[model samples]
Structure formats: C-alpha cells, structure tokens
Target: MFWEPLRARFTREALTRSFVALRIRDYRRWSIAQLLSGAGAAASQIAIAWLVIELGGDGIALGAVTACMMLPTLLLGPFIGILVDRHTRRAVLLVTAVAQMLIAGVLAALTFGGALELWMLMALSLAHGVAFAADNPARQLLVMDIVGRERMTSAVSMNEVIINGARVIGPAIAGVLLVVSDAGWCFVVNVLMFVPSIFVLLSLRPVAPAGRTEPADSTAAAARPIGAWRFAMHTPAIRATLLLAVCASACYNIAVVVPLIVADVFHADGGTYGALAVAFGLGALPGAFFSATGPTMPRSAEVRAMAVAMAAAVLLSAGAPTLPLLFVGLAAVGMVVMWFIARANAFVMLSTPTAIRGRVMGIWAMALPGSTVVTGLLIGGLADLTDPRIAYGAVGLVTALVVTLSWRGLRSAR
Candidate 1:
C-alpha cells in the first residue's frame, strides 16, 4: 500500500549536521529561489482553493480542478524526464518560472476584471500543471547537481524544510490578503515572487562531483523513459520506493478536504482554513529535521514504519470532533508526511543510476502529485457524497492496509 522513513534518534550531533548543505553557496542560492517560488506557488494554491469556495463550487469542482492541475505530471512525466536528462535543468526552471508568472498574471487580471469563470480556472490549472511537469523533476535533478551524492539526503531534507517554510509563510500571507482584499491580490503576490526568483536562478551555477554525474550524453535517445521505467520495476528497491510514494500520496493533499471541513463541519471562514494549514506546516519542520539525519539510502523497515505512523495520523484527524483536535491531527499528519517524503526521495535518487535517474524520477513524481489525478476524485468524491471525515478515514485505512499486505515486499531494497 505505502511505505517510508523512521530512524536514528534526534541526537544533538544529528541536529548540528542537518544544515550543513546550506554551507554550499549555490545550494543556498537555490534554496532562496525555491523559497520564493514555492511560496508563490503555495499562495496561488490558497487563492485557487478560496476561489472555488467563492464560486459556489462543490467537492466535484474541487476534485476536477485538482485533477487538471496534476494531470500533466502523469501524462507528460516520462517524456519530461527524458527531456530533463537531455537539457540544462536551470534553463528549464527559468522557462517554467516565467511561464507560471504569466499564468498567475492572467488570473489576476481576470479576477480584477470580474471575468473568471469556473471553466477558465480549470483550463488555467491545466496550463499551470504543464509548466510544473517540467519544473518539479528539473529542480530535483538540480539539487543533486549542487550537493552531489554524499550529501543528497540531507540536502533533500533541507529542501523539504524550504517547502514547508513556504507552506507556512505563503498561506499566512494569502489568509490576510484574502480577508483584506481578494484572490486577485493573492495572484499579484504570486507574480511578484516569481520576478525575484527568476533573477536568483539566473545568478547561480551548479556543478556535480567528478564521476558521480549523469553522463554528458545530450541525446534524448541516449536515456530513454521506457528503459528507465523498466529499470525501476525490475529493481526491487525502486519498485518498492515508488509504491510507498503511491501509498502516502493517498493520505495528504488535505487542501482539497480542508475547505470542505471548514465550511461543512466547522462552519468557519477562509482564515480558519488557512490556520489549519499553518499547524500542518509547523509540524512538518521538525519532521523534516528528523529526516535530515538519515543516510542517502533509506531502510525499508523504517520506511514501512513511517508509512504506518503517517496513516495513523490521518485517521486521527478523521476522528477529530472539535476544531482544536482537528488541528492536532493534521499537525501529526504533517510531521510524518515530510519525514517520509524526504527519506523516500533520497532513496529513489540515490538508488537509481545517474544515466536513467531523470526518467525514473519522472515515474516517481507520477506516483506523487501525479497520482493525485486519480486520488483527487476518490478523496473529493468520498467527501462529497458522505462526510469529509469519511474521506480522511478511508485514506488512512487504505494506506495502512496496503503497507500491511505488502510488508514482505517492502522489506526488500533500493
């Protein structure tokens, strides 16, 4: 069903070593750029979610929009991975940043002009997803370029720190903007963040360690997506790693359900919806730190254990009878969620050979946000027809079962 990380106690030595990757200049620059870009992305997500709510859209509309946003990752993933291996990562990221900025700018104008229709938002979501399909894997490969193999796990964990940091700051900004202004202003903030991020990206150069690099092959035919997918499946570690991502993918994406919770269960406003996300982001920081101490190659047992912990946390949230309890449950979920993802990513990246790493990572990405194409419907539909709580409970229960049934298989390797 699902699997991921849990390991060595949080010793003082582990704590001190976590931030070591930031000591590298290029990684630091990349982190800052990612922080800005990730924040803008997060803010726009909040804006989009709020817009759906404002538009009188139901769970079905929410699921469809989410599906559109993630679909390109599934459809374009293999081809994009091949492209990633063939081209320069920084150039791809720059192009994506500019494209996403334009998309957000268009939405801002539409919002200001009072011309946004639900179909328009869905179409834009598709366009934005197409850009992100290129953005996600290229940025991931770039991290390896900056940090190299030895430090990749810690670097990835730190990257998760930046992402969770963005989650905290971005939604908080959106919460305020949405209250004082509207989604149009939030989209403007998205546009502004991209401008500086593009400049930061332009200023940096990345280098890989000798002999640890993906070969200098510039041909798309040199590293085929199909060959990569075959490698991932035939290899025990990668196959299991991909499976764990699928299992965990079922649990998170609470954004789709959070609004439904605030409106249907808590009878709260947009601000409360944002506050719940803040609790989640806060919890993720320590979890990301916990993951930072792990080796570049993760342990399967630990992966399985962490997946269970994450599932239990989701089920806990499902049973929350009060708003405060809901916050606690979601916080617990955030903790395990980041912890698992950081380790899982490290294992996948380290386990694969550099030649096909891009393509395999593409398949891996599909299991993540890409898998959301199918999951958005399941979770959103469950909430739509029944209570939102059922959606949460189903996610938790199904994930736990997947892990339990696949216990022996997950114990294999990467």
Candidate 2:
C-alpha cells in the first residue's frame, strides 16, 4: 500500500512537470519550426567549415568566416530589435526564414557549379548573419508572447533541448553525407529543411507587441529604439546577464578551438571531430530537460555559479591528456553551459517588461554572438601563434576570475 501511493505520486508529478510549453498550441507549432530550422543550421555549420578547409582556408581564414557570420548581429542587433518590437513577430520570422532559404539555395548552387570562392562564402555568411539578427530576437520574444512569464523558463529550456538535440543529429547526418558525397549535399539538405519552418511560421497566429493593443500613435513613444538600450543599461539583472553572456561567448569559442584540438592535438579525422561535437550535444540534452522539468535555483546565483563551473570544465578539457579525459571534460562543459544559458535567458525574459522584450532580446542576441567575433579572432590567433590548449586555458581562467569577482554584484541583482 505504501509503495503504491508513492509510485502514484511520483508518476503524477512527472506527468505534470514534463514539457510545459507543448500544452500550448502555438508554442508547439513554433517549436516544431525551430527544431527543423535548428537542425538545418547545425548541418550547414559543418558543411560550411569543411568547405572553407577544402578551399585552402587556414585557422585565421576560418576565424574570419565565423566572425563574418556574427558581425552583423553586433552591428545590426539594436536596429533589428527595434523592428521586431514594432512589427508582428510571426511576419518577421517568416521573412527571415525565406531569406535564409534563398541564401542557402544560392550557396548550394554555387558549390555544385564548382564556382564558389572564399570571398563568396564570406559574403554569404554576412547575409546569413543579417537574417539571424532579425530571426533571433523575434523567435525569442515570440516564445515569451506565446507561453507568458509563468512558463517562460520551461519553454526556453525546452527550446534549448530541441536545438541541442538537433545539434547532435545534424552533425551526425552531415558526417554520413560527407562520407558518401560532399559538402554541397549538406547545403542542399539544409535548403529543403527550411521549408517546414516557412510553412509553420505561416500557420501561427500573429503576435502583437506588449502594450501595442492600444492605438499605434499613443504607443509609439514607448516603442522607440533608444528605450530598449536605456532599459537594458539601467536594469541591473539584464545588465549583469549581458556582461556574463559576453564573457561566456569568449569561453565558448570552443567551436573554433575544438576543431584545432581534434586536428592538431588529437590528430583525429573528421569522424572523431563529429563525435566530439556529439558528446557536447548529448551532455546538453539532459541539462536542458532538467531545467525544463522544474526550478533548480535562484536564476542570478545559478547563472553565476554555472559560469564559474563552466570555466573549470573548459580548463579540464584544455588540460586533458587523453581522448577519454577530453571527452569527459567537454561533456561537463556542455552540461554547465546549457544550464547557464537556459537560466540566463529565462532570467532576462522574466525580468524585462513585455513591451520592449524584442529590443531587450535583440541586445541579448547582440552580446552573445557579438563577443564571439572578437573572441574568435583572439582564440584563432592564439591557436595560430602558440597552441589551442593555451588559448582555451587562458580564456577559461579569465572567465572564472571575472565571474568570481562579480558574483556579489550578480547576486544583488536578483
């Protein structure tokens, strides 16, 4: 009798806690679109990196390409955020999806024709980045709009789970495609994958900005672009989160650093590189799910602690003497990183007023990837000059120190 009641309670709790966002119809549709788009993007990442290497690009060249992909976010994030707040989010998403599809198609055609050049790839990366600036803020705000603050944390965590799960599957698929054919096929597949996102986006109901249910002229003052920047600057929690995000971006330049490690340190092939990527994704899956299921800790301290833990994990990966140790370190890093990102995103979403959420998220979008442009160059140059391991260690140590010193301030923000 005791065991039966206990099991019944546990089952009831599990059912209640699982995937809270899926209960909402629009969020479900949006999530499906995100999954397909995320997977396509992940696969394209592998294809793009491999293409650059095939075209005689080195570490710096690869870094330049990565930087180009992120530069537009840094440059155009504020403006795009303003637009996102002013326009219907679903419309913004539809336009971005279509733009991305067209860009991928052009890239695929060029690759197939054997006429693709490095400059052409960089130019396309810029265009892709521009599309992302609009897409990132709109999609993030749309989740908030659909689910509201009560379930925002679970919704964001679930979204991360989908994206990271796709990260695992996408590269594995790309690895297989690379074995049979070439990078162009991966781009071709990406083009087709975008179709679902376009369709789903079309079906979603239009989302109005917060406070925009009133007359447009009356709300225009509140919707001004400068207001978003001012709010983020004055808001303690948002300000600290953005700072931490930039620091995290520097430490997170593992995308560039890991490939170098696989090639130079481990002397591994493409398959091993894909396996490393999968390891990170696999670790992130549980972390995201855990966050989705229930609360962990106070968002502020939670983010700070995770940042420090992630730094330690990166150092462990940097100092790993063997492949097994390296993989273990990476998995740890992935878990902590995902938890940190989920918490930080939720914290920002919950803390901000819904009226300027788009602009706020746009700032967030800018800070996260914008830092990568600088760190990419730093990590890439360091890898080129000395060793990738040293670069990783330096970045991690610096991140840990910065977060440690700022912990009190971050805690107070809550």
lDDT of each: 0.82, 0.78
> Which ranges of candidate 2 are over 4 A from the true structure?
1-18, 145-150, 207-238, 353-358
lDDT of 1 at 396: 89
| TM-score against truth, every candidate | 0.91, 0.87
Q: Which candidate leads the pack in lDDT?
A: 1
Candidate 2 to truth, TM: 0.87
The digit string of per-residue lDDT tens for model 2 on 250-294 reads 765566777778778988765666677778888888767655654
Listed per candidate, the RMSD to the true structure in angstroms reads 3.8, 4.3
Model 1, residue 137: what's the lDDT? 79
Error of 1 at 2 (Å): 21
